[model samples]
Target: MSESAQQIGEKSQVILHFDLKLNDGSAVDSTRVNNKPAKMVMGDGSLTPNFEKCLLGLSVGDKKAFSINANDAFGMPNPDNIYHVDRTKFASDAELKEGMIMGFAQPDGSEVPGIIRSVAGHSVTVDFNHPLAGQDVIFDVEIIDVK
Candidate 1:
């Protein structure tokens, strides 16, 4: 099949430029900014199922913009992901501020990033939810290739 005739499918390899934005029009990420497009194999778990659904049946040169809800996108924030830690757990020299992202070591030795939600007298609130959790997102995509 001709490259231009190939459509995005469950097993197709796709190359595309994409812009991710929030509902309020704030840009989250864009492949176009660096002049480099992204490549991915469909159904490989790289893109969310709902996001991939938007690309199905699209051929090269196709451009589309779609919106995904919070639950379907990054997912809704889980209240259990929030934790309160003693302020002493943080380095004495480290400045803790709301909205600051910091990496915390897990029991398995892998590091997970958490956002500082607040700092009280001797306690700190951190949230481990994905940064975009609970927010609707807009995806703008231009298909460059499908193989």
Candidate 2:
């Protein structure tokens, strides 16, 4: 099958370098150097629709680049995601610091990463939401090859 018509369970290898940036053109993530090949399964829900669409009909040694809008990338952040926690949760001996990354449990029995926001007398405010929740992100994808 052609790269664009790749089906689920198809085994393929492709090397790609990509840049993730904010709408303001701030770089967030990129796999430019140390180039590596990534294997993907179609219909696994791993790649966003927009991203998948861009990958369609590609071939090995085919170098194609494209950009994706925020909605198709990480989506916007939700305000309801911010949360608060008790300072005592961190052992008395533990030092609470701002910008600390911690894992918090969610109702779905999943761990959500949170960043420490502030430390008050007895409370530690944390933002469990993704740091880019409210912002739109840009994805720069390049297809190095496809099987």
Candidate 3:
């Protein structure tokens, strides 16, 4: 490759390492620590629209860090996302405990994750909100490739 490469465009494919953190510096995820790079097309659903927008015009080997509000990143937590399911849904073989995340199948055959919040005698509350909802997040990214 030459020393100068064109900046990323709308349809470019990108490879990068990223660190996602909370305002308090708690690590949500990181590709650098895993020694793996992430690759994604610009307009694909793999990357959030806001996150992709941040990468536009960046060239290879560029590193940048930025912060975004929760609503723009993962979104605010919705009260409707909390569900109270019947305790019987869990069979004896399955464990029913708080803070346990489970995948539930929907009518469209897609699976969404739900975290158990509480377990009562006959009711179980599950929260479907993303774990990072309603929090400010900081993103640190290093562009490894832009094609």
Candidate 4:
């Protein structure tokens, strides 16, 4: 008994199994192990509109699969998202690892996360953009239950 996407509205708790893949048909992530279902509320930012649309009205024990483009997923990469920081920022005891996420403070008294791209003697290159930016992803989802 699968419900249509329209039946799954805002604030409705839904449990689903998700599988993510790249355009090359390579699997990236999945939640099928032990069938541990993930829950989410419709219309929440957790699931994109396009992705949610695919599950509009779906009853429990329903399985659905779909894909989202780069814009709908992680979005296109921005050139301005790259930044270089002084090597001194790293503590002497800290080891710089590429792809490591670090927090950066902004002038507005807020903090943002960035990933380490490269490490030079006196400079450390950090990329603030998301790791999946500029890439299209194919997501497969199954509605385990909707409450």
Please provide, for model 1 over 1-147, each residue's C-alpha lDDT reduced to its tens digit, 9 standing for 90 to 100.
864459888899999999999999999999999989999999999898999999999999999999999999999999999999999999999999999999999999999999999999999999999999999999999999999
Clashing pairs in 3: none
Stretches of candidate 2 exceeding 4 Å from the true structure: 1-15, 61-67, 105-110
Question: What 10-residue stretch in candidate 4 is worst by lDDT?
Answer: 1-10
Query: Of the candidates shown, which would achieve the greatest TM-score relative to the real structure?
Result: 3
Rank order (by lDDT, best first) = 1, 3, 4, 2
TM-score attained by model 2: 0.70
Off by over 4 Å in 3: 1-5
Best by lDDT: 1
Angstrom error of the Cα, residue 22, model 2: value is: 1.8
Q: In angstroms, what RMSD does candidate 2 have relative to the true structure?
A: 3.7
Flag regions of model 1 displaced more than 4 Å.
3-5
The local distance difference test score of each candidate is 0.95, 0.66, 0.89, 0.80
For candidate 2, the per-residue lDDT at 76 reads 69
Per-model TM against the reference? 0.91, 0.70, 0.92, 0.80
Of candidates 4 and 3, the better by TM-score: 3
Global local distance difference test of model 1? 0.95
Rank by TM-score (best first): 3, 1, 4, 2
lDDT of 2: 0.66
Cα deviation in Å at residue 84, candidate 4? 0.7
Name the weakest run of 10 consecutive residues (lDDT summed) in model 1: 1-10
